[model samples]
Target: MTVKEGMGEEPERYRVEFASGTAASVAKRRSFRDLERNDIERDLPGWPAQPPFKVRGFFGKLGVHVLSATTGLLMLPLYILAEALGSPASPEKRGELEERENEIDDFPVMWAGEGETARTLPWQLDPSRRSWRTVTEIELAEQDGLVRIWSYEDTGRGSRHLSWGGGEKVPGSEAVLWSMPRSEITSAEIKRFSMAESDFTVSFRDGSWARLTSSPHGARRIVALLGQGVPEGCHPA
Candidate 1:
């Protein structure tokens, strides 16, 4: 073959050796510009050859492995810090709040009149709905075994304002329906009923004057009191 380079005819010859120690020489005459213009050093299709991969030995391999492990370890502490900072309350904070509430001796006694017998209750007292809050103060004075019951909206904070008087009446049959810790008695209005054996005091709601004999009844009362402003919990069944 004839080859031309830079306006001059030239002989282009090259030798290549294979892994098996076999060698071959190819001779041709072509323009150098053509060889430069086209890539001629690449293997042809179907030739069993692949590009070489550079491998780093021992220390280089160890360094990469250490770097990957170190990156993961560093990220762990950051992830933990983020979670700790974002959490609302730790377990200890919740426990402390509970303890403080339990220690509080003076909690207000609030009740809502919203039931079948609400209108009949004495405390049909809707403070929120009324334009002018009416506070009725009643004092119970027992004379000669006659009991007087009255209602009061004042006695200052932490003071109990409760009363129960429905004329001197025979005490109902003593039934120990339930007993709760003294702490559970949020608002207590005690009435002395003349029992056959002795005078027994009964605790009941100020509004309906219905005797609360079970924890469930007391729990319902507490719910009514605390859930007044909260719409979902305040609505009566």
Candidate 2:
């Protein structure tokens, strides 16, 4: 099978061709260009058109909204009483809120080379730590014999505001946290810690190990790559 990607006047499109003369095409909305290009692999047929609207449907939605508002109002006094009792404390200071928001705005974007597949997964380096979780980004390309992985810092460099109200962009450095050839890996497995976060660990023939936490999708991708006998273990332990 072969895959091709390109940009055109319309949305970015990808074409996949199989040797048996079968083919599939995918086109993503322009607004979602920043999302992982390979996500088309999981695309499914769109849902059928909605049924005609009915007065009963409208009243059903209205009833739901009314019930939700009534419940919220009923809980308001209890919420206020809890706050008055100093159960949850007062509102956070503006500076503290800004600091937290800055931390979130700094997350990094991981890109892959042509013909390569990459994904970023939520990760927790130290579950015991009170700080927020981090992320692990990995890329693999069998044709290029490449397997690259990077760990982005939870807190990124300060935000950069874009002109014309384009919002802000956070710049993440291109630093490889860990990398190794596909052929070096002898075994790989997921390790679960009682207090610490679970992580995927690759054991090398040289007796070294590299560990990383990843989302379920990322873990599956890593397992598939390791199954291909990619070299592993860039760091000791």
RMSD of each: 46.4, 22.8
Clashing pairs in 1: 2-29, 3-29, 3-30, 4-30, 4-31
List residue ranges in candidate 2 displaced over 4 A: 1-135, 151-169, 192-198, 228-237
Q: Can you give the TM-score per candidate against the true fold?
A: 0.17, 0.32
Pick out the ten consecutive residues of candidate 2 with the lowest summed lDDT: 16-25
Candidate 2 has what TM-score? 0.32
Worst 10 residues of 1 by lDDT: 16-25
Model 1 collision count: 5
Candidate 2 displacement at residue 208 in angstroms:
1.7
Q: What is the lDDT of residue 225 in candidate 2?
A: 54
Candidate 2 per-residue C-alpha lDDT over 6-88 given as tens digits, one digit per residue, 9 for 90 to 100: 24222111110000100011100000011332222212123122222122245554665676569678877877888889885
- Please give, for residues 67-161, the per-residue lDDT of candidate 1 as tens digits: 65686687677767767899542111101211111112111112223331212223212222211212321111112221122222322333122
Model 1 segments beyond 4 Å from truth? 1-120, 131-133, 144-202, 205-237
